[model samples]
Target: MQYFIILTFFLYGLVFGSFFNVVGLRVPTKSLFNPKRSYCDTCERTLTWKELIPVWSFAVQKGRCRGCRQSISPLYPVMELTTGLLFAFTYYLTGFSPELMLGLLLISLIIPVTVSDIVYSRIPNRLLLFFSPFFILYRILYPLSPFYDSFIGAGFAFLLVLLIILLSKGGMGVGDLKYYTLFGFIFGFSHFLLLFFLSTLYGALAGGILMKMKKAGRKTKIPFGPYIGLAALTVFYFGEVIISWYLNLFL
Candidate 1:
């Protein structure tokens, strides 16, 4: 039964992942609701159920449009599979709790934002605005989170981000500050701090490798959204374990 439930969530997540791909592609262009249907970019053929079965369809089609035989992006199936795995893991962690629901919604929002940021080197304020209210309301209803922690997190993170921006002078963008504040709202002080640490560490490692490979130079702009989203997700899912490990190691 437990395994079945996890499988069900995985399947459900795949469906959501397909929609998330739509959101990621369309939201940035402001075509999310107007399109009303999914179509192939190359052939402009509307996809039917058979062609839109998430990862399975991509695999069967060999990642090509049926009408034009043009190659489709591997990101489609990758997004579907990643979302599916995360959904199953989240279900295993939180079961049917409110955290499970909110976490899934948060993932839906972050995935698109991450993709757009990576591609365009910009984060959409519109997307962040869309989810901010939901984050606030979730906090109010849940009431399990610390009261002052979120405020402190928002303040400290905002200031810290602003300071970094000013000191670095165009090294980071305003969108990052907005995103950092959003992270604080979702995670509060302690977890937000940890998320920041992990994100910085990951970003540093990636940047170093990229610079070494000559793929990116010193002035090359790297989008911070993906790293922040990734670190936030990591802290959200494994925060207690990470905290406990730290405690055991130190004290």
Candidate 2:
């Protein structure tokens, strides 16, 4: 019965992931509700039920549009699978607790923002605005250990990122500033600090590898939101463990 519930979550996640892909691709353009149905970008043909079965559809079509025969972006199936696995894992970890809701909500916020960032190099403000109230309400109902940490973390994240933006002069964008600030509020002070460190570390390593491969130059503008999302998810799942281990080493 436990495994069955996890499987159900995974299935729902796949469906939501597909919608998230649509939301990510459309929300940035302000056309989220225009067509009111999924359509092929290449041929602009409305997709049928069979053509919109999340990851299964992509697999069945061999990653090509049925109408235009155009090769589809792999992002679709990948995000769907990622959401599914994360949903299942979150349920496995938290069962029916309130943390499960937080976990699922976090993934929902992360996936679309990631898709938008990867494709448009932009994180839509509307997306952040939409989720902010939910997070606020969540923290109010289930406050952090040190409830004041939310305020401190938000303040620190704002000032630090703002300073970096000013000093680097376009090194980072405003979207990242907002994103980090929200995450700070979500994770609180101590964990937020670790999240920042891990995000930068991930970005640096990826940038180095891309440069080494001659794929990206020194000035290449790799979107940082995805790294931030990845770091946030990591911190969500394992921040306590990592923090404990590091403190033990120092002790």
Candidate 3:
């Protein structure tokens, strides 16, 4: 039974990963809602059903468009596979619960934002905006917790990032501030501060490594959304455990 659930989760990841590819490719160009089938950008030919299979299809085709034999970007398969692994891991961690559903939704939001920010150095507000309502809905579905916590989280995170931006003389982008609001709302006030602290630590460590390797210049900007996404995922999976550990350290 456990094996079956894991297999199901893997298959689910593959399917959603395919959809995420569409979202990542189209959302940035404002073509996500277009009523057209997927097509090869190089050849302008509609992709066949076989070509549309997630990670395996790319590998089978040698990462080329069948119609034109143009070399497709490896990023497609990488994104698909990454999402698939992350989704499966998330399911394994959360199982089939409301938390799992919310976790999946959060993961979906993170992938596009991560991909876009890495490629374009900007996160679309539209994507972050979409996550806002989910906070309210989460509250509705799980009402034992106070909805006000979400608002408090949002406000606190916004102010915290805003202060950092001011101190750094416009170092932070507005999109990041908006994105934190979603994180704050979902995480709530109780855990939001820890999430921010941990995310900032991770982001700084990552950025510092990139700088040391000379892959990024000292002043070269790195997107913060991915770090927030990572921190959120961590909190979702083990918030109580982490909080308890922190409290134990002091006590």
Which candidate achieves the best TM-score against the true structure? 2
lDDT of 1 by residue, 1-251 (tens): 99999999999989988888777777777767784578898778888989999999999999889889999989889988988988999999999999998889779887888777876777888888998998888878775355777788889899999999999998779989999998887788888889999999889988999999999999888888888988989998988899889989999
Instruction: Point out where model 3 deviates above 4 Å.
Output: 67-70, 144-146
Ranking by lDDT: 2, 1, 3
Name the top lDDT candidate: 2
> Which residue pairs overlap in candidate 3's backbone?
none
Please count the clashing residue pairs in each candidate, in the order shown: 0, 0, 0
Task: Score every model by TM-score.
Answer: 0.93, 0.98, 0.90
> Is 2 or 3 the stronger prediction by TM-score?
2
Candidate 3 on 44-82: residue-level lDDT in tens?
898888999888889999998898999988878887787
Candidate 1: lDDT over CA atoms? 0.86
Candidate 2 lDDT, 49-69, residue by residue in tens? 999998998999999999899
